[model samples]
Target: MKSFAPKFVWFDGRYVRDSEANVSVMTHAIHYGTSVFEGLRGYWNSKNLNIFRLEDHVKRFRNSGKVYSITLRFTDRQISDAITALCRKNNARQSCYIRPFYFVGRYGINLHVTEKSPTHAAIVMFPFGDLFNRNGISAGISSWRRINDSSTPPLAKMGGNYLNSILATQEGKRNGYDEAILLDHLGNISEAPGENIFLVRDGKMITPPSSSSALEGITRSSVIEIARDLGYDTVEREIPRTEIYFSDEVFLTGTAAEITPITSVDGKPVGNGKAGRITQKIRNVYSDIAMGRNKKYSRWITPVY
Candidate 1:
């Protein structure tokens, strides 16, 4: 784990030094986790810097804010521009991760915030590399189950919801596993700590549907599209835990995780126990797209510079 300190961060209304961008201790988001955020990646391709699915990320950010009753002071285009400006100001000429967050800034203990309660938005960019082992990762079925929509909406990228993920991930790490795959309340496969899970069987790609309490990930959607373009059939349905152990291949997808192959689940080898042919093909094509080498999916990348 290397430290990454960016030169500038897009604060409430302007760029500020990384150290100057501070939040109050009594902030509502810190107390009750009432915040919405988005995670995206920007790739430096020679002289051209590109951000993947920038608009889609912004849209999700706005939607999450709306769901959580956190009003964003800026529009989608404004936020997008601010992120790009922040990256350029930091002189980030390499692959970096972008985080845009909206939170309740005012101090109060009450769950209901008044109009006087301030809302703040910030964008930060920093150098980020692989989030998981690229070779292959081992995962365990977590003891902690996935939270259902009735409690807190899992679809929104809310900060509070990640506490569940944190618990599950910590449990996996303690058990000598690379990651954790959480099952929904009904015992059906949901997703990993921070990524969507997919299993290949008989050459068809299968993943848990949104109804199964899985986050609607942008990268997951991209994988489905890419797989279809590669002449593979994709299905969205409830997955059983045992199915993963018996599947021909397994993988996870997300903004941070990207496309990570799951070699084993709960100590059981997935098929041959190595990255399968389908997973490798998808990973290679995804890498090409991220590096601006795939013109077929050029629209997915937004030029920042």
Candidate 2:
């Protein structure tokens, strides 16, 4: 916490100090895990600042809130503006991660609808490094399966849905791996807990479609577009359970995880146990765009400085 910048946070339509901001202890979301949030990154380019895919991230955040029945009083555009303001207030020019949460509030054990329900929002910006373990994230297939879409829509990035991810993530850590890849109920490849999974085979890129009970990550789409521009064919469909075992390469993409190459899966070497060429290229392109070096993709970032 010492490295955290002394800065401002937007909460319930107001900006407050990180240390001073407070919410009710008996909040409904806190108890019931009925909250939605987004993780966004602001990069420092030594000249101008960039918040990667600002609009898209806010739109997804808004959509997540809607899925959980939390009404966002602000539009995506408005929320984007507020996020920019909060980042600037924090003077967060050093590649920061921004988090915005909308949660149910007040004392309600039975959760009796909007009559006793209150919604509160909080936005926090902090200097964030790689979310995946920085030693380049060696991974394994998780014993924990992803929650079924019928039980809870995987499309919605709700808080309750993360328990499965949490268990899988911890499983990886306990087993001396950096992350976990969870399978869907049908035993098909789903995703890493917080990142979208992609595989490279025969010089082509393939990832599970949005229907694969995945979070539809912002960075995942960014990498796909950049890959297409780089002249590589990108495919999205239902990736099978054995697809990963034979893939030449594997990687996960997200705002926090960024682009991490997977060296192995379920104890087997992926393409001679090394990062594939296509995966490395996509990672490089994404790094360039997020670093404010690519003018062709400048629209993805909003300069805070």
Each prediction's Cα lDDT score? Answer: 0.90, 0.82
**Off by more than 4 A, model 1:** 1-5, 114-117
C-alpha RMSD values across all candidates: 1.8, 2.1
What are the per-residue Cα lDDT tens digits for candidate 2 across 1-305? 34547368998778887667787788888898888889898887777668898888888888877765676767777788888888777776577888887878875695654523577777888887777543255788888888866888888888888988999989998988878998887778889999999998888899888677877888888988999999987899888889898898899988888988888787777887777788888888888988988899989978887
lDDT of 1 at 215: 95
Error of 1 at 79 (Å): 0.4
Instruction: Give the per-residue lDDT of model 1 (tens digit) for 201-239.
Output: 999999999889999999999999999999997899998
Structure candidate 2, residue pairs in collision: none
Estimate TM-scores for all models. Answer: 0.96, 0.94
Quote the lDDT for 83 in model 2.
Answer: 88
